[model samples]
Target: MTIRKATFDETQRILDYALVVLKESTMGFVKPRVEIANLIMAPILADGGYYLIYEKNRTIHGWIGVGTIYDSYSEEVVGTIPEVYVFPAYRGQGVAEKLFHEAFRHLKTENVNKVQLNVFAGNHAKKLYEKIGFHDVSTLMEKDLD
Candidate 1:
């Protein structure tokens, strides 16, 4: 498998695959009306972030997106991984580990002081993140009004 950065021309394909994963894992609990491709592209075009994909034989198997967050109060820049998804067929095959390493290599060059990501309480990937040196710093809770 090879890891590479995604191009803007491939935004729609990426968004489609990502949306499927989002819906399946979250049980459609989280829905966004805005074009997610825009969110993925904005950071990359701004030179502040990236989206990396894992591919084999010209087929995309998984992807991870990291966005930049600038803290005005602390004057610090951090990398935030908003999404990481490996296609169901590709799960448990180390695709995510490879993708994370590639993303971190890029982030390291940008002098990002830290990286953060949110994982649902029941997602098994949280263990993978922990094994890769990520620790829980906070808990996020939400209440649905509708």
Candidate 2:
């Protein structure tokens, strides 16, 4: 398998996988799911963000997005891993782990002081993230009223 930078031509493919990842892993509060997904991802490429894709035999198996976010509390620019997804067939083969490490390495080159990502409660990848040294800094709680 090989990992490399994704091209603009591959944005649609990345969005396709991102849609699946969001549907399967998140309980987001948004309407018109497609638009929401696009909104979250569109700026990545336009503003110098990037994704690293993993592939084997010329077929992409997974991807991870790497970008920057200004940390209001710390007053510094930090890395934000907005998304990570591996095809179901490729799960359990360390694709996500490799993507994450590569993203982190890239961020280090950019002088990023830290990195963060959101994990929905009960998501299976949460364990893997913790294994990679991520720890909870805060929590978000909401209650719906109707």
Among the numbered candidates, top lDDT falls to: 2
What TM-score, over all chains together, does every model reach? 0.80, 0.92
**Which candidate achieves the best TM-score against the true structure?**
2
What does candidate 2's lDDT look like per residue over 12-91, in tens digits? 67877666767766855443377777777677666688889998999999899889988898899889988888888999
Backbone clash pairs for candidate 1 read none
Report the error of model 2 at residue 116, Å: 0.5
How many clashes does each candidate structure show, in the order listed? 0, 0
Model 2: lDDT to the true structure? 0.84
Model 2 clash tally? 0
**Residue 54: error of model 1 in Å?**
0.8
What is the lDDT of every predicted structure here? 0.76, 0.84
